[model samples]
Target: PAAAADEPGTPQGPRAPLHGAAGRPAAPPAGAQPAAVTRTEIIDRAKTWVAAKVPYSMTAYWSDGYRQDCSGFVSMAWKLPANEWTGSLATVADRITKEELAPGDILLFHNASDPQEGSHVVIFGGWTDGTHTAYTAYEQTPPHTRRLDTPYAYWNNSAKYLPYRYKGVTAGKASTAGAGETVPEAAGPASHGVAGYPGRAMFGPGADNPYVTRLGRQLVRKGFGTHYTKGPGPRWGEADRRGVQAFQRAQGWRGGAADGHPGPETWRRLFS
Candidate 1:
């Protein structure tokens, strides 16, 4: 998911130099200290960068020496040790609902279990109105630090926009106040079943196995499991295959092309 360019950055007017003499990340904007930044300070610095129109690139890191992808941007703002991926980042955050979204929270798109279809993460700036139908957000997408509006065509297509709060940051303040928030690093490769895709691919109706069972569950989640009348257990029956085919068709592949097999794209979309 973090490997490809799903959303390209567009030209956001004039650009400012964001690197030091050796091309390292430049200093923080006015009023914010990188050593002990606050949640509000994080948002403020992000907003300032947006206003400065820093360019975006999936392969590049930010001026602060962090990867430039969605998750990388979050890690940079949150001040993590290295660039983090979307799947791993989700582990450190508590899932929240749209009603619970607040500044400093993350808005993510795509399946966290197995982010094959690709994923995007943005920082919630604030609500555009009281209705919560729309809101302002900041993200590193094509162009730079984009001020995104909710219900955006590409991001609002499915039940993928998840809200998350870093475990260290709290309701009204950072965990350590003057010392800034001390985010807990994710432990290990997150277990897939409950939080990610089971480490293996579920491409066919093989023998009864955990991968098949996981496939069935994903199919059911995608609303393509009409054939799963009994239940989606560990069995790899016709139901699972049919469900996969249906999902493939929905994704624009058809007939022989939509064979009930999981290819790279099919797997990505199914997990996504």
Candidate 2:
């Protein structure tokens, strides 16, 4: 049954462990391959609940078999093999920097001491602007699942909301080309007609040139355009950095190599 009120405040006293409709514990199914999800897939799944207005319930389970609460909402979005609570959600996700946040990532606040005092989670839709002061948040609370323009992190406990990305999530398939858009095919280093590795000076902060435009176009072609709300224009912006980083990470690069700056190798791979 749905809670009498929508707020996910902690219930008083000790509580029984929550489970799925099948009476299984809130953990991934044994011996199952983790779902290789995409950002689009995660956001699409989240929107279904928002559209359906799935009600909030700690004990009740939705038809999809996930608990109808904050953590369950994220589990459903990530398409985990089973339901997960705030305490266990991190097991399947990696902590990410705020700057690395992109659509389909989550801002999680797990209150380990109380489990519910003010713990919550919200899916990061995207930054509302270049300022990075706020974002579009998709969440399930009280009344139901909702999409909101929330402040950086959240309205309350803003400092506690940390970013995370699902481990199984991929860069996703190439985006369908819009009219007049050219979709670049994945190519090897020897592929003919690939562009030369533009000098690194053409990218990074405060650098703007035709190469920036070229890079943005190629990023769009390669399906990393989710960061760009309007133009992947010649201007070097956070969108460009994020797109580059996402592409770099897609290639299994990390640390300094995936720092979001396009070096010679990154440029070659992107063009390839």
Q: Which candidate is the best by lDDT?
A: 2
Per-residue C-alpha lDDT of model 2 across residues 57-147, encoded as one tens digit per residue:
8777788877788888888899887767788778788999998887788999888898768888889887656688977788988778898
lDDT score of residue 270 within candidate 2: 81
lDDT of 1 by residue, 1-272 (tens): 23322454321211122333466444345434223444554564565557667667655545576665567667667665445566666656788877766667788775545464546777876554445565566787765666656552135333667788766563232221111112122211132222343322222212345777777888888898899877687745557768878887787876555656544345556776
Q: Please give the distance, in angstroms, between residue 39's alpha carbon in candidate 2 and its true position after superposition.
A: 0.5
Quote the positional error of residue 192 for candidate 2 in Å: 24
TM-score of each: 0.48, 0.59
Clashes of each: 9, 1
Poorest lDDT segment (10 consecutive residues) of candidate 2 = 173-182
